[model samples]
Target: MSSSNKIQKKTKSIDATKKLAEKIKKQALLKQKELQKSSNQDADADADNSTTHTALSKATSTSPVSSTVDPDAQLKFNTFAELKLVPDLLEAIQQLKYTKPTPIQSEAIPYALEGKDIIGLAVTGSGKTAAFAIPILQSLWHAQTPYFGLILAPTRELAFQIKETFDALGSTMGLRSVCIVGGMDMMDQARDLMRKPHIIVATPGRIMDHLEHTKGFNLKNMKYLVMDEADRLLDMDFGPVLDKILKVIPAKRTTYLFSATMTNKIEKLQRASLNNPVKVSVSTKYQTADNLIQSMMLVNDGYKNTILIHLLNEFMGKSTIVFTRTVAHAQRTALLARILGFNAVPLHGQLSQAQRLGSLNKFKSGTVNILVATDVAARGLDIPSVDLVINYDVPTDSKSYIHRVGRTARAGRSGKSISLITQYDLEMYLRIEQALDKKLPKEDKPAREILDALHIHVDKATAEAIRQTKEIHDKRGNGRRRKNYDDDREEK
Candidate 1:
């Protein structure tokens, strides 16, 4: 209470804060070293090693990753099937052709099924879906009442993808599930709430919308609550919405919070959202398998599209995702790729739910080898055998770079993250590198060979005409719709 006491406490607190960050940094550095070391070994082995699996062989260069075995866990346990999965869920898993429990599933399911709140620290495509979904489904099977399960994802793509996971696992039991997110019919979601569905996978904003607008859409019976990508949801400032949902929903529900990185803010969010908790971590930060061959290239601002096109051609026939900064950028990149004769598609927030689903399905089915997406389209949507993740626009931050690269090299698969940096992108590139704690290798002309693969060689005059027309359109002539109103006004 005295100033002297407060000063001493403050000094101690600063010291403690430093210690915590250092602890996290040290743990992160250690894991990163492991991944880097493994990557070095894998890279030394083959240029075309599959990015998603551990069974690495030069012969299976075209195969999608089949499995990723955690070395640390192998010492303690061999497979996920060894874990005591409840009968019904195990049957469901078998039907889905899942032969083994992924690392997250193996680690998280037991404690979660025991009714322990969980903090799952794992990367995207690390099988975190099954980690939480299996336990929740198993719990649902035993409950007498049709209590709702609530899941909050950071993006519409992730929310919908989570719904798909639930749908797959719960289909046999007739457990109905719905995904609620922005850019969709909120009123329809409100109507669906009246149906008393067993699970609702949603983004924070729309879920909050339903809670605020719908009558008798009570979450008082919500028995399971999950916050996927907790850091991003919190970073995007969904805290108020998350809190409002918490305030209105039953406080006694079981909670699960997951994130790739455990920042201080994430810690506070967990404290706010979770009860007594169990922690399940597959790998510490940067502790991924050492098979990813990450690199970066620098280009001029005007030549960004040219560079991205070259990379796509160079890596042609490989399933890949390009992370663009905005929806417009995604569309531009997709258009350019298509114009140049690449089988590419755009995936972004502006698209309808049907389009989003269609794009991802096309990519997954390998009908389209290149998918361009905004950050919203990047998270939690798993498409197998993606060999490369190109940051057409280098991520504004490191977390995004991680999430972007994570789309590839999933499980034990070897993958690569290629960043295209221009002069304007220098600051952002440095920030990403700083956060990632590394520097990129500079390549002189990575684009020359890839450019040769591009088939769009139109004359300058033809391009000028199209560019002029586009410029005119961009100035808001045809894009705007004229609204006509009746001259007569009548009182209601």
Candidate 2:
């Protein structure tokens, strides 16, 4: 073909694509209006008999008002039923035994159902996932369109967890959702995308890869965009990638930005992405759950490992996570735990995607009762029944400390966190206490004779673990090992 003919052909294709996108958007809008009409009719029919419907009607009467829902805000809707969720969602919630909405859920869901942009600020494990998932699924139920929602998570683990939530909640609705994350095969993900799922839960980096490299996949007509863990996403320098994604997706879509803390970067992101969003904050500052029992153990650096073993022994047969600051620490700690006869595993970013998932499954399924993890496991992961969180290494910052401990004591469950405070960690620990506005009480030390006796076994285990780790590193070769063994900093 001649140059002019080729140019004209390309232009025609572009025009056709735009027109198709417009058609899809119109159809989605029309379906949504119909769903709204049906919902209103149902509400009117049951309003006299349903106090829940009356409350929901009053809550959503305004045009997506912008206001903060404090932790103590009188909850407008207590139960999922009172939130006026569709019967399908209500049934799923009932099956899941979710009797009442968490504060964040009760505050955010009603506005989200009203098609409003939202800035949801809540700590980890406050039912933030369900807060956003319920509304998105409800919208998907009404519209039934492919690629109806796109949820961006910070880590691959979080992406998969979010997909699981969507699948479970939308089970009765026959929901088709795919998780697009790194560490999995690209071709497999491409095939999943070809299936045209209703929701795409993904980490920003991998999703951006698909958007750029994968043919026949895009989010141009996606109706809902949820940036879960917005602060962590920005902290990982996903702002540039998020900007690119925001450019491609339709601006008319509803957006929900949920974060633990609203930093300057998050505020900037909100301004750039959300439009007149209602800000719902369940907790205004850095705080752990009230149900969490936090204490500190002052230890000498030489005996830190022994103290860790001592605590693990006390909490034996219970689900616990040991938080380390480095990949090597996590690996060696898990090895040490196993040497001393603890059912333990390690999870960090250094492991291949398969290994990471395997470790998580082992911990989640009770195959392993202990997980030694880096900061990677601290945020946005919903691991239930964590009886204790042990801070093997004091987190570098208060925010990180909060997230690490947040892994336990979730959803009103009682849990405990013990931080090992060395002389070096005292300054950092004090900063954390200042951030929380309360000093943590000192944990009673075990009898000296017990610790002295335990030290012998721990020292032997430590020596064996170090030797094994060194051998493994040597086999991998120094240069390659160094390249791959960086701390668990970025998700993928």
Candidate 3:
């Protein structure tokens, strides 16, 4: 073989090896380019994800309104439709003339509808009742079971008011509710319970009484438990009673705790009763409604009554609630108003249940333009037409002041609260102002002519109120237990 032929074969082998290496190198470059492209795509996706997250965060946390606009005002909801409530509830809301959900309702209804426990902080008349009620009714309207929900309110009036709301909202669904409050007969309540009502609205004390004494009556099947005016309910020392009720009911249940303000007791109650709850607060700062006009008129203690009479004259023919510190004061004030030719009635714990209901009816029906009440009427009574709330006496605490003034300016209607502040009430007035986070407007005292004109009726009214109050006490005493002939004769 020639040396040139052998070299050529070796060169051919080397050429083949080079060609294979070039092909391999080209494949590797292509693969590298593909991997780089994939990495770039992933980086683009990460950037997109970051952009999405930031946009969502902005949407949820930031409002489009101007910086000068109220931040809380951005929480407004336009209609009940947006909350996805069922037709029945929407119909009831329409029939009740409620066009939109209040802030508390809008924030709370969804969580409640999702079957979550809730801690709602909103003032009265913010539609907290409907917030919980609509969900409870929606959940339980189809159930054949009895006593599906139990609501504990701080006062009997509030209990009744809650029951009324439930009945009104659930009217088309044939829902039945029993209000177990003290002023009513226990036997009657027991009878109502026998009917297996869907809801039980009761004050803690009366409910505890019925739960302990009533035979075969229990809330073992209660699917929901709601504490309305939760601060006052817990602050009133209903813990033991609430615990007993909780123990009796099913452990798996939804609980709603609503309050005008948060307190340590309410927090403890949350720990005890509510599961992991969504906190929906419309007003974190202690503040009244936007429409409430609160004012204070400084006057001498002796002139307080005269000023009240004049104010009543000024606002006559409009419904007013006069808050007094004592039952006797409420009675005296009402009697005085009545003697002044104003339609007035007295409401306090001391009044018989019949008397209390009568007074409330008169005030609500426009039969009487004025209701003189102690703190018993403060918390959750929903009288919508009250044009003014007169603090005939300064409230003992800021919460009381809030509740008393809350009687008017309800359901978004504008109203006024004029407090009669004497020199003795200066400290309390200041405390209320501090709690409100704003000072009340100062108003000029009534004119001399106004006082002088009303002064003519004061003496006659005072004497008649005193006599009628005595008669009321006598009637109550006589009704409670029969007095012996000798005792009656001695009293006479």
Candidate 4:
């Protein structure tokens, strides 16, 4: 054929390819629209109004419910009974005393059970673990497979918490879950893996370590991949580790990505991890829960400690989490609270894994009612007993503020959060308010009167707490240096 004839043929082939591409895009969009419409329909029929739930108002005096119900009111699930969950799981839910589903659970569980990819955007303490755990358990109830699901979390504590949830919900089914995280015994984790467990709850780095080194262990047959607290995972610089896991996992598996906030990194992760996902965003705005009563108290430059002490005394015997900006601050504040006769514990990255877990367990078990910590405990662990969260130190940003306050007001429970703001925290406080799109309520009581009621004296207790904090800090620093020296010598 002539050159002109060949050119005409190539151009016609190009046109055909373009037409096919357009058709595929149109089909995908239509499918998305259909899924969205169905989701809207689900929302219309099954939605639960958590803000107005009786559970949240049992003790508050004449608490008024929001007059406006979301237009998607029909999509909420009022109770666990309405979810069509398996009988065993429902029994477990009842045993756990979960009468109603939080918004995230109400919305995400249905789609997850259908084996669709999902991106659940909810605040911390929004019952996201159950949203994924229920469906995974329901799928694995009768599966003879060794590992049916893989749930990834940013921190070991979060991973362990997920594992506990899985164990509780699947207890009747005799299902098992193995936790893979750093700082734990690798051989023990390997032994657990050898048991042919049905679920694997792990952190990204440790999971990669096991996948690369552990013999005869793989997730090739895994059916579901869940990245809980996905935003914090990426923010912690686990992107490369996540990529490695994705490459090894089966391409046919369903995925559920849950996060408290959305960022550029989270969006990219969603694109890389999910396929045709249904986005379930219960919290589009960077705001705390409707059940959370947030307030801020302005303090003089040197009076934050005094205010914090007063507040802790005011909320004595209640489950409270006190967030400090630094590990040293957490330690000092916790020691001070202890000296003040409050049952307090400290949680920070500086502690050993066992100690961190022990601290958390103590807080959860009510052995210790006050938990002092840095941002490490801010994101994903749910403690329903936390009725109050005191920002001993104001958060550095809006995202931190959201997560910090989220430690309370969990699972549709009414809770209160107060931030101690000084002149230095004013700028960050303003940014937080702007991010939340509303001004926090100011404390109604006068500062002098509040302090007078508490009658706190900081002379001896404060000095001793500061001294204890310094001693602990020095020991940790020295231990780290010793480890480094030992490692260097071994390499030689």
TM-scores of the models, in the order given:
0.76, 0.84, 0.80, 0.80
Q: Which segments of candidate 3 are over 4 A away from where they belong?
A: 1-77, 478-492
RMSD of each: 21.6, 19.7, 13.8, 16.3
lDDT of 4 by residue, 1-492 (tens): 999999999999999999999999999999999999999987766545544565556645442111222424654678888877789988998898878777777777777877788888877787889888888888887565778999998877788899999888887778878888877788999999989888999888778888999999999999999988887778766777788889999999989888889788876876687776878876665967888999998887566777788777778788999999987799898999889888999997777778899999999999899999988898788787789999988988889889888888876689999888888999999999998889999985456876655544654678889998888777768777465333222111
Task: Please give, for residues 76-127, the per-residue lDDT of candidate 2 as tens digits.
Answer: 7877777677899889999999888888988888888888898898878999
lDDT of candidate 3 over 1-492, digit per residue (tens): 999999999999999999999999999999999999999999999999999999998877633111111325744468876766668767887898778777787777777888888888887778888889999998986674798999988776788789989999987777888888765777998999989999999887777777789999888878999988888776666777778877778888999888777788876777777776888877754668889999999988867788888888888788999999987799888888877788888987776567777888888889888999999898879898889999999998988888889888988899999999999999999998988888788888776887777666675677788898788667767545332222212111
Report lDDT per candidate: 0.74, 0.88, 0.81, 0.82
lDDT of 2 at 469: 70
lDDT of 1 by residue, 400-446 (tens): 77778878887778888788888889898888777667777875555
Off by over 4 Å in 1: 1-71, 75-81, 286-289, 443-492
Q: Model 1: which residue pairs collide? A: 38-290, 39-290, 51-413, 51-414, 52-413, 53-412, 53-413
Backbone clash total for model 3 is 0
State the local distance difference test value for candidate 4. Answer: 0.82
Q: Over all chains combined, what TM-score does candidate 1 have?
A: 0.76
How big is the positional error of residue 29 in model 4, measured in Å on the Cα after superposition?
Answer: 49
Candidate 3 has an lDDT of 0.81
* TM-score leader: 2
